[model samples]
Target: MESSAPPSPELRLDNLRSLKVLGKGGMGTVFLVHDALADPSARSPFALKVLDKSSINSHHTNLDADRRARWEIQVLARLCHPFLPSLLGTVESDQLLGWAVPYCPGGDLHVLLHRQVDRVFSPPVIRFYLAEILCALDHLHSIGIAYRDLKPENVLIQQSGHVTLTDFDLSHKLKPKSIRTAISSAPAQDNFPETRSKNRRNLTRWFPAASENKKGLKKAKSARVSPVSRRKLSFSNGEKSNSFVGTEEYVAPEVVRGDGHEFAVDWWALGILAYEMLYGTTPFKGSNRKETFRNVLLKTPEFIGKRTVLTDLIERLLEKDPTKRLGYVRGACEIREHEFFRGVRWDLLTEVVRPPFIPPREDGGDLTASGKDIADYLCSLKSPPPFPASPSSEYQRNVSYGEF
Candidate 1:
C-alpha cells in the first residue's frame, strides 16, 4: 500500500477546496476539505479521503479494487444515521489519479482514547458509546454490508461526544452465495508447519474435543489415539484460501481458525476495546507477535476486581466459544438490554447530550485549542519528564493478522 499523495494544486475539482491533511495511512490520505456548494455560513465541515492512485492502479487483474470503492460510495450514499459520516459527494478528476470523500472534524476515537487513558467514564457514558456503535453495525448489516474493520481509529468522536463510524475501504458487500461458501469453509492454520500442531492444541483449549462420550476421562484417552491425527483439517475441499485480515489484537478466534467469520467478529473487537478502556491496557497483549497470538489462543483474560454487571457483559462478549459469544446467540438487542446498560435510552443518545468526560481546555478558550491543549497536557503527565524527539513507535508495528 502507498501513502496518500500530497494535495495537488493542479487537480482541484468543483465544490472542493482547502485540502488540509487529517491523517495518512498505507492506503491513502484523509483531508479536511470544504464543500463549495454548501451554505458558506453553515457550521458543519466534511473530510475528503483520497485513495492512493498507486494502489488502485497496481492491481491489474482485479476489478474488485474499483468495485470496492464504488460499493463504499453507494453504501454511504444510502445510509442516513446520526452516527455515520454523511457523503457529500465523490469525484474522479480528468487526471484520473484518485477518489475523494467528505471530511469529518471530530477526529478519531483512537486519538481520544490515547489522550484520556487516565479518565474512567461512567457506565452510562460507556453504554452510550457502545449503543451508538451497535446501531451503526445494525444499519450496515441490514444493508448487506459487513464492516470488516472496526477499531477505535475507524470511529470518529465529535466535540459534542457524538461518535460516527468511518473508513469503508475494507468493507464488503455480502452476497448470499458467498456467505454460504464462507460459512461452509474449514479452520485456518498458523502459517508454519511446525506451528500446525501447536495451533490444533490451542483449538482444543477453546472448543471441546469431538467425542461421543461426555466424560473427561474418555476424551483424554481419545485425544491420545484419535483416528484423525493430522494437524491441519480443511473445512471445505474447494473453498478459497483464507485471507489474513483484521488487527492482530482484536481479531476473533473464528477468524483465526479459518472457520468463516461473519458480522459477529465486530462484536469481538468491541469487547477488546471495552476491556482496554476499562483497564488501561489490552487483556491479551504479549511482547512479540507469536506470543501474543498464543495468548489469544490459549490464555484466559484476567478481570481486576469485584464482579459487576459490566464484568459479566465483558465475559460474555469475550467468550471463547463463538456460538456462545454475546452477539452470536443473543443478538444486538439482547446486548443493549444487558444489565450493564440498565438505564440507557438508545433513542436519545444521538441528541447532542453532554458526554461523561470533556478533555480539558486552554486559557485562550478556543475549541480548536481545547483538543490540542488537552492532548499536550496528557503527554506532560508521563513520568521521567521526557518528550520523544520523534513520533511514538507504537503505531508502527502491525497489531492485526490481516494483510493490508
Candidate 2:
C-alpha cells in the first residue's frame, strides 16, 4: 500500500570492500561489506544481498526468483520501523543486481540460541524479544505485508542488543481485511469466547492426546524441493495463498494442507518460533519432512512441565486452526495482551540500554595506517554520482522496480 520511493544513496558497490560472505540462500548471497570511502579508522559496514541475473534467470520458471528479489527491495524500501532494516542503496551491473541495508554485528537468533547455556532463552528474555518481534509484525501487517518466513535465522540481533528482522524475499503484500470480515471468516470463533476463562478451557481440552500412539506412524518419501517458493500467489487483499511456502517445521497447518491461507499463517509461524526459542526445538518436527507436515496438521504442541502462561500463549498461537489462533481476529493486539507479555513495557522497548546481549564491535585497528591508498581508489571510480541532489528528482528518475 506504500507507494513512496525509498531515498537514494551516496554509496556504491565500487565504494564498498567485501568483508565476508554472510549467507547463501535461494534469493541471493549476503555479504558483509565495508564502506571503502568511509574513514578506515572507523568501521562503516553493512550487509549486501546480491543476485546474479544469470543464476536466477537460467530457467524459465526460475524467472520468478528475479521478481522476488525486486519485491524484497520494494518491501525494504517501504519499511521505517525500528525492528526492520532500511533499504540503503541498490546496484545494477551487467550480471549482478544487489541491494544494501545496515548490518547487525550480532548474529541471528539461531546463533544466539546456541550460545545460551541451555540452548534456550529464559522467560524474561523470550518476552523481551517477542515483544519487539510483535511490534515489527504489527507494522508489516499494517502495511499489507505478510512475512511467510518467521524462523529464528531471520531475526538478527543488532549491535544495540535489540533484534531487527531480515530476509524479505518470501514476504508478500495483501490487502488488509476489514475488522468485520477478518473476524467473521474465522470459523473457530463461532463457538469461542474471547474471555480468558473460556480460552483456557478450550486450550486444556485441545492439548495433545497421549492416547494416540506414534509408534505405528508410517513415513512417506517425496521429491525434494525448496520448502518456501518465491512465487507471488495473490494480488489482492483478503485473498488466500495456495502456493506451498514456508519452512517445514514452521509451516502452518493451513499451509501444509494446501488450504487457502492469509495473515493468520504468520501467527502460526510466530508460535513455532517462540516454541523453538523456549524449547530449543520446534513443536511438531517429525523424522521426515512429510511426517513433519502431517504432525503440523494433526499433532498438538506438548509441554514438559505444568502449564504456565508462556505455554498457554504458545498453545493459543500454535492452534491447528488458523481462525482460532490468538492473533487471527485482532492481529498482534491479541498476542500483546496475552498473559505471557503482561509486564512488557511495549512503548519503552527501544529505550532499553542493555538488552540480554550486545555484539562485540570489531575494531578497525587492523587497517593500514592512514589508509590513503583505499581513499585514492575510491576517488578513481566513474560510477554514477551518488544519488540525485534532491529527493523529488531522485524519485522521478529512479530505476523502475522491474529494472532493479
Candidate 3:
C-alpha cells in the first residue's frame, strides 16, 4: 500500500503573534511566536521559520535553495526521536513558505559554549554533548539521510538539557546500502589508502614535547597540491555528492577537494566540534577562507595540553583520508565504542534528570500579558523588522532573543 503523506500544517498565521525574532538567513526568518487562542497558562508557543519564497527565488538563480527549504520540512515530518525536532505544521501563501517546530528555550550549542568561563567546555561537558549529538546523528544516518551541515549552531538544547538538531536544509537522502553489501564491502577512499601517513607526514609519534616548527612545517607540506584540484561531484547515499556545500570550518577535506562526500563527512565535522568545545575555536581555522581550506587539507590538529582519549578521538575523526576516519565503516557504533565514551549509558540518556545544564524555565514563558505587550511592541516597530535570518545568516548565528 502507498504511504499517505503527512497532514498539512494547521497553524494559522493570523492567530500567531510574534514574541521575538529568533533568527534570519537567506532562506527566511525564524520567529519565537505564540498562539493567542491557546490557554493563557499553557506553553503553546513555538518557533516559526518563515521563508519569503519570492525573495529566495529572486536571490538565487536556481531552484536548489527552494528545494532545500522543502527538504527540511520533509525530513522533520517523520522524525520522532527525542534528540530531533518535531514538525508541528507548515504554512504557505502566495508570497511565503514556512513551518513551525517546538521552540527550544535552551538555545544552541554555540551559545552554551560561549557561556563557559574560558569559552571552552571541560572534557565531561564535551562528552555529554557529543554523546547526545552522536545519538542524533546515528538516528539521522539510520534514516538514510546525510546531514551535510553539523555545527554548534545546528545543535539546539532542549528544556531538559538534551539536544535536538535543527536546520535540515543541507541534508540529503540516499538509498541505504543493504546489510549484505555493507558488511562485505570495505569503505571507499579517494585514491588514498586507510594509512595516509605513507603519502603524507607521519605526525602520530609527535608528543607534547615535540618542536612546534617541525609540526607546522610538516603540516604545511602535507597540504601542498598540484596546480589542478580535485573536481566536485554531486552526492547520494552509497554514492558521492559533488556539490560544494557545508560550513567552511566544519567541511571535510573531501568536500574541499571536490572529491564527493558522504556520511563520513559528518564524522569529520564531529571531530572539529570536539576540538572547538575543548579549545574555543576550530582546529584548522586560518586568517582567511583560502588559508583555512589549505589548513584543512594539509594540517594536523595540534594539542595544547597532554594527550588523552578525547584528543585521540578528535585525531581519528579528523583523519584527512575519509576512508580511514573514525565512524567510516560502522558509523556511530564505532564512535560510541571509543574510550572517550567509555561509560555512557546510551539508552538512558533521555532519562537523566540532571544533565550538565538545564535551561531556565523562566525563559520559556506561557501566553502571559507581558508576552502580549512585547509582541505588540515588536509589531509596532516603525518598520517592522524583517524576519530574523539567523543560523542562516553569515554572522547572526550567535544572536538570541532574551526575554523579548
TM-score per prediction, in order, is: 0.65, 0.76, 0.77
The candidate maximizing lDDT is 3
lDDT agreement with native, every candidate: 0.51, 0.68, 0.69
lDDT of 1 by residue, 116-221 (tens): 4353333334555676777787666555556768877777765455677887867655532232212201111122133333333211122122221222211011
lDDT (Cα, tens digit) per residue for candidate 3, span 191-305: 2233533333111111112132233311111121111245644443366666677888998999888887778888999999998887788888888889999999999998875
Root-mean-square deviation per candidate: 16.5, 13.9, 11.7
**Superposed model 2: Cα runs more than 4 Å off:** 39-42, 180-237, 367-404
Looking at candidate 3, what is the lDDT of residue 112? 71
Q: Give the TM-score of candidate 2.
A: 0.76
Sorted on lDDT, best first, the list reads 3, 2, 1
Error of 2 at 387 (Å): 32
Model 3 spans with C-alpha error above 4 angstroms:
1-5, 40-42, 54-62, 178-237, 363-404
- How much is 88 displaced in model 1, in angstroms? 1.3
Model 2 local distance difference test score:
0.68
Instruction: Give lDDT: candidate 2, residue 379.
Output: 35
